[model samples]
Target: MSDLREVAITSDSSGQLWNACVWDPFVGTTLMTYKGGVSNSHCLSFIGRDFLISGDAVKPLLHVWALNRQEQIQVRMVCPGKVGALAISPDGSYCVCGIEEKLHVWQVATGRLMAVIPRHFQRVTCIRFTDDTTHFASASEDGSVIIWPLCKVVSMTQDIFRSISDSAEPRYTFSDHSLAVTNIFIGKGGMRARLVTASLDGTSKIYDLASGIMLLSVVFDVGLTCVTMTIAESRVFLGTIEGKIHPLCLHTPPRSLDYHLTETEKQNVFSEHTKSITCLSVSVDSSMLLSGSLDEQVIIWDVPSMQCLRKLQHKGSITNAFFAIVPMNVFSNNLKPSLVLSSFKRRSDTENEESYCINVLNSERILCDKKSENKESLKYLAGQVLQLKSQVKSLVGANLELYRGLIADVWDGHDDDEPDPSFESTQEVGVHKKRKIKHKKKRNLET
Candidate 1:
């Protein structure tokens, strides 16, 4: 009974090599790790639960994997330009790839190029589709959020070539930020979607899609790297480079004096990640929170209890990890610990002093790929892959054991209604404190 999970990661620490690793949580081990000749591999998406899309700056080729099997299976499709970001539709029928200056739309089943969106100031940073699939939006480094009508793009394609069909026209473009936009996310629900975007300018803005008007602008103390909304859309979580979490609620006033800090909801700042925050993921039910950081650590936090679950170790600064939903969630202790996708790069000799050499735990077999001519780089990459595989295998084995324990406990009545000791004793809530605002400086800088 393997508990398989998916985790993806990127390693940019080593300027020379780019690597990606996948951890199968059910099997409790890293099923595969890839490195070498890959310049940049970002914007990963699953095509129909079978293929994985990943590529870099020079190569516009999208590396597709049939997830049904373990190995990197095929190159399903190749785009015209470098893919900077990618997003698959909610229903998994289509996918949008954002290149340096264009957006390409493709059909998931056949890998046919459907359309190309041209003429942008810089690379598209992120792309997302509406729930209905009627429209899609893409963000650029140029500080603009463009919304395209899917019906129009599809209709225009019959007469024109497929590549020129689904262009992301400007439904609304936001240029309020003086700096480049870093991330953008559309809220869940129905029509008139809410667009929340963050940038290098240390500000997060919410937009009304129907009216194309700015709803709220949140100015934080530091630059925000990533932003995500809870499943209920009642709370917004912002992560900063300084390794802090700012939780804001949609129900409260966006700019009131007490808006940022609520009386009942305590502010718990977890300083587990030593470096910059790379990615943040909250479970669908908002019970668990996952943070990947440049410090090469993955910290899982129990949301309601505010206790650290397990500081999962990794080889490189975790590029990203998604809590992918699977069948095991229904019978598991914590459904949030399903799949994690992390990417890492080789480290320099300086970093090796603190980082342990990657080793496979609880397994007798070891990977035989020795260091190449570049001993240092090979050692780092080899260690990274070994560690990733070890973590994946552990997850797979542990998940099966957890499920088996759950069944036995259910039948034996030994663990029923008993809270996990790991969660209860450390449940001390954090206190609330307010930071003095420099209104004059804020006004002076904005002006």
Candidate 2:
């Protein structure tokens, strides 16, 4: 296994052609391109470090690629219908394909069908495995999420005589969303592992997996399409249908029915996308954020600064985007990560039709402490310099006017016209005596 970090992009282009391209971010080059697969679906995932599993919606097949061997292993008839979603177990021993409302579990090593579980009433939108691999979750258009135990599902495949009643029910089923559940993500391993779900009902909810209670429900104005959490899980990054990214702090209580109306909430919004935001991915380190939209743009954001670092263009609307660590030993210094994006080419005649394409973008520069500090310092210094220059110019103008006024007074010979203090006092006394005499004359005339 190579230690090099590579980003794999899967594109569904026009003409029913799918291309999977791998990029080396460190060298800024395309390492490989596997083209001409017949899948318009966005069901691609990395199975361990070597194999890539892709499910085709147009064709009922699963294509597995071994990067080291440069060969593809085809698993035919994986699903009866189109593969709506897919998830691989953390241990990489099993894979699950979501076909409409049913789920098909397959053993990876032997490519044998393990079990078929029919659960959701609507098409499954997303699926994910827990960090421990003991559980997996599926979200559906029915606005519900069900967490299933991996042991029970595997047991059904092994023991035919075992009564179906002996198998336990799902670990938990969350039915809080009113509309289709667009995405679901299990928190990183910890004591407080949580499940976060986004829905078309314009809300995202956080649930405590252990207690099976809703911890927080955040309501937004626009429907949420996707979500990702930070490393600490203290904040959630959400993608909305309005092409906006909203970061909600878990610690803060919801102030109103619409959280976006709050003053504090306004600052965290990233509004670069002109079309609907389709996906969001945060780096493992939690320092960078990647967002892809129907606007055909992938924006790299500095999480702390909330500033866009780079923008990557796509030939079509982006379906999915994520950041992954490159295998370490390939680079002299393993500093930067790679961005993988899956997009589709839009049809001119049919606005609803699109084909997929994959793009692997290289991050030539990584977000660093020194770089952030320097950028801040430069901005601060530049502002101070501009302020000081303005102040100096104003002071010079005021001083110049004062000097001109003083020179005019001195040059006008106004000193000779200055009044004497003694004459001014005598004039005041005479005016007072004249007023008293006028008052006595008026009294005598009345008598």
Candidate 3:
């Protein structure tokens, strides 16, 4: 386990404690630690291989650091308010920073300000890019999901409110959530794509991007702390503060409405973590899963087996985490991606308590530190994500006619004459053709 490395990070607050740290889990090694800021670091992104981008509370700037250089690459200050979230595009050309009330897109390499996309009335919490680089989705504290065209953002800003003129206008807004959206992730597998989101109201919603409709909804007893998707398979993982993890298998084609879970997979709870799970990271290939929790622990589970393989403990509550995968070599399949773990502890808690330190743990020992955050900043960002979701949803709704047009193209043909009865069934649709073929074969064999 010592072969694994560690980096620690911490952020600042008034108490000089509760700051979070990111580090390697094995042997309690430290990698990068950010401490003593006005607000805690809530969002992090790995840009251009070794460069890391992070969003904090008070500093309206997004912190960019060169991981190999172990130094700050640039402090990108663009937003007027606290930088609440950060997301890097797949190509690493564009990075989206979620400011308290606005969103800014910056070029990662040159640190150039590409565009300033104003946020909604509510604060923006999370920003994510679709599998295809053509678009990105954002969630707001207002309980909405806004899908934006990456290519048209700059141009659209010019006539920003054009869609607002008609209140009854059919647009692209998706406002199904009744509460603030805390997390949003786009899942891609096979030929289908899904926008997965979790909210403060203890519900996880899955939306079909092509149709811009809510496809599936799951309610949990506890508020959802985070939601994540893997690339290798169509698994949507949700972490709830109520001490449970729900995994959903994304469906496609004729069975799209069948969102029920198998008996063995329902309420798949892992009780090792004493508290809520805050963040999650899946291996690039989706073979492994890692989770950070308020219980001062990180768990690495075998995705296929759903068995916990490692229990990495921290000195305090874990804040966030990311996996750094090293390219494969001539001898091995691929070097296991090292787990970059982050944690935080309250500074003033009694000395005997574990709340005062951040710990990095891997297969072995845990590293510890005591740092905290300014509570105001955390609340500010959490609230902002909800607000941004609504504004984006409204923006989406403004383009609703466009989405409907797309669906219409698929479902409703231009031919004035209705389709023949034999072809009218859903089985005639291209997506469901294979299922229909299978059913026909079974029926013939039965006869």
**TM-score of each candidate?**
0.62, 0.66, 0.59
Count clashes in each candidate, considering only residues at least 3 apart in sequence or on different chains: 30, 13, 64
Report how far off residue 278 is in candidate 1 (Å): 1.6
Q: After superposing candidate 3 on the true structure, give the runs of residues whose Cα lies further than 4 Å from its correct spot.
A: 1-42, 74-78, 109-112, 156-171, 189-192, 251-267, 327-447
Ranking by TM-score: 2, 1, 3
Candidate 1, residues 1-447, lDDT tens digits: the string is 233533433333332433455544323345445443242423665544434556554565655444443335434345666677888777566677777867776655444455666746887887877778777888778877787776665444443333343343566667887676777778776447788887877888888888888878877767877777777777777777887766777896446422234444434565667777767767767877777777877777777766777766765666555565433332334323212222221111221233223222223224434444357687889999999999999999999999999898788886456777766545532111111245556777999
lDDT of 2 by residue, 1-447 (tens): 345343534343332323454443323355554444543344767765545666664676666655433346443334566777888876667787788898777655544455667778998889888888888889999999998888887664434433232354788888888999998878887324899889999988888888878877787877999999987898899888888898877777645433444666755699889988877877777777888787877777888999887776666666556666544322323323232212111111122324322243435444467878789899999999999999999999999999999999897887657889999999999999999999999999999
Overall local distance difference test of candidate 1: 0.62
lDDT for position 317 in model 2: 68
The lDDT for every candidate, in the order shown, is 0.62, 0.69, 0.61
TM-score of 2: 0.66
lDDT of 1 at 246: 65
Best by lDDT: 2
What would the TM-score be for candidate 1 when compared with the true structure?
Answer: 0.62
